[model samples]
Target: MSRLEVVCPAGTPAALEAAVAAGADSVYFGFRDGTNARNFPGLNFSREEAEEAIAHCHRHGVRAMVAVNSYPQAGRAELWQRAVADAHALGADAVILADLGLARWARSRFPHLRLHLSVQASAANPEAIAYWTERAGIRRVVLPRLFSMEDIRTLVPALPVESEVFVFGGLCVMAEGRCMLSSYVTGRSPNLDGVCSPAEWVRYGREGPMLTVRLGDVLIDRIPPGDKAGYPTLCKGCYRVRGRAMRPFEEPASLDLLSRLPELMAVGVRAIKIEGRQRGRAYVERVVRAVRGAAEQAARGRPLDAPDLRTLMEGGRATEGALARGWR
Candidate 1:
């Protein structure tokens, strides 16, 4: 088996150390502002914090990939541009980006810096992947989580750029990084603003036995006493479809593919990305440790001893998700 690189998340400088110490091959994070996809308040790094994180990762022989993944809003392209320049200046191993304009600008500005296509682009097929690789000079494409192991096995061999797949963490029901679910409700587009279900707009209330959940003005879901009250993202919420209330799109859960390491390795994927940048250091430590061990076991032809990371997850349950070609 190829030695699969474990790409973990680092919301802060402490999480960066925790991930590296837990045996990550690399760590991915973004700036504190809207320059990244996980722009939650109190999370992410300042320019000085980013510099420290990168230095720490390099000292431990791990690469640090900075995320400048959000699309630039009109007339605010300078913020995105500065983010790319700062990441390169700090010696980040790569910059994970989504916008084509930003990608082109960064490629021209920093020819030596590695550019990774963020999953927001959702370029699953060979021809689409090739567009980024041939034109923008992206060294790696963070493959969308929409692909199954079979799909990856078929796709990876055809691509020239290295592939990084999300083996574990939050499962996006729609094509990743591309969805406007949050924007439809709150008017804050995650693709453009780098936030999902922005906390200011999320409100929860209990009307007697029914738990009323609202994302802005829309009533997203109502759950009874015994039902699970998931964090109210529009996609994962229970919704009305054909006069029945059920999760037509997705259930609230994360993706834990600990058991599928060998299959992923066989498919020629160079790295496994764990998705969660707004989480704490403890979450980063636990997940990084578990995935690192799993990668090592897969290298030795041994089964991965599953580590229960549900406590570290959002709603306490996780699934194999589309990596198993999840039921529609």
Candidate 2:
């Protein structure tokens, strides 16, 4: 079996170094602006930092991918274009992009720079993937979080380019780049501003023994004093459905797929991406190390000794996500 590439996250410079030291095949990160997703406070690299980070990765024989993945705002396309140009100038191994116009511009202006289709592009089928590969020379496509293993088995061989899937980390229930729930609650858009339920608008309060979390003025969840509280992303919030308060959309849980590494490899997946650029260096190091070992074992046709990552998961809970059988 071909060895699967472990594409890890690097929200900060420290995280990038940690990932490389922990044996990541490649590291993906974004700039400290609205041009890419995960545009959060105290996260992502500045241009100079990106240059240094790419150089550091190359020195360690690791590939660096810059995420210019957010859609450009109307009349502010230059910011996204500049980010793509900057990634090329910094010698990024690839630029993960979602915008059609920006992809075209990058292909035309910097033909040598490899282009990747970010999950934000929501191209899960062969037809869409083929279009991007044929038109813009996309080298790889990060599949959406919803595809099952069987779906991947069928889709991988038919694709024109390499396929990457999110094997671990936080899971998005809604189709990528299409969710506007956070935008409705907060003015920020994950697609345009590269932030969803941005930190500035998130607030916490206490009501006697219960802890309340709000995204702007809307209450998302209320955790009992001893219960673990989760970040207040609108979709993961508890809401009233059919007169009963429940989590109708999705419960707060991280995605864990280490147990399925062999299946992923058997199906011809080229890379496994970990999501969490907003996380810290410790998280990056531990995750990369565990996944590296798992991928090596899978490549060797051995049983994967998957690490128990419950504590590292969101709310100390994890799911196999859409990989679960009977998932529609």
Candidate 3:
């Protein structure tokens, strides 16, 4: 049996160390620029900070992956190219990428560097995975959050490269990196620029006894006084379609599959991912520890504990996500 790698998030240097100390096999993060999906202010790493963090992880026998997973602007490829070079120079175990051009550039420029495809590419099948691995040399592909265990098993036998799947944290309802909901409202792109529903455009207000959450002037949800208010991320927002208003895309909840660790490993999954790079160190540490404990237990052929992930979930709600084989 292959040892399942516990891939955790690290939005900052402190979070990187926190994840590593929490028993993560690998930690992934991005730079302060628009090169990553979590482009929120006060998050992400500087070049010096990234170098130091990579060295720290290596010293502790943990791997570090730099996320340069955004599309480059027209005629302005230097920024993305430099990020790839910088990651390689700092001894990153790999670079997580999204754009086709960026992947090609990274493979050509850094022939020996490991390249992992970001979930943003939406490669859920073997054909798509092979296209990148053969053409751009992507060694591993992070499967989108839209596949079931059956879907994963079917794709695994045909895949030419290794696969990583999200096991915990924020659930992306839309196809990874393909949704334009944030840009339609905030004029900020999630794929090309690495930001979705940026904090600048989010607002919370009250109407009589109801709390309303707005994203760039568009009212996403209104809750009663006692109901919890979630961050307006477009996808999780309640909306009206044909006179009825409800959360059609998905409810505001996090993904917690810690109890299903044995099944995930049994399906030939190489890595288990936790998704929350914009969160704090405490969140990073707690989630990492929980998933690590469960994954390690499963690796030893022991039953995994039903982890109490309520404290780490959004609005105290969590689901198995598409991994349970639900939805179409």
User: Any idea what lDDT model 2 has?
Assistant: 0.91
Q: What is every candidate's alpha-carbon RMSD to the true fold?
A: 1.2, 1.0, 1.1
Model 3 stretches astray by more than 4 angstroms:
none
Descending-lDDT candidate ranking? 2, 1, 3
The lDDT, on a scale of 0 to 1, for candidate 1 is 0.88
Q: At residue 328, what lDDT does model 3 achieve?
A: 54
lDDT string for model 2 (1-328, tens) is 6899999999999999999999999999999999998999899999999999999999999999999999999999999999999999999999999988899999999999999999999997899898999999999999998898888989998888999999888888889998888888887888979998898888999998888888988988888877776677887888788999898878889999999999988988999999999889999999999999999999999998877888998888988888988656
Residue-pair clashes, model 3: 0
For residue 137, what is the lDDT in candidate 1? 94
Query: Best by lDDT, which number?
Result: 2
Q: What does candidate 2 score in Cα RMSD to the true structure?
A: 1.0
Question: Which of 2 and 3 is the better model by lDDT?
Answer: 2
Clashing pairs in 1: none
| Colliding residue pairs in candidate 2 | none
Clashing residue pairs for model 3: none
lDDT of 2 at 95: 99
> Each candidate: what lDDT?
0.88, 0.91, 0.87
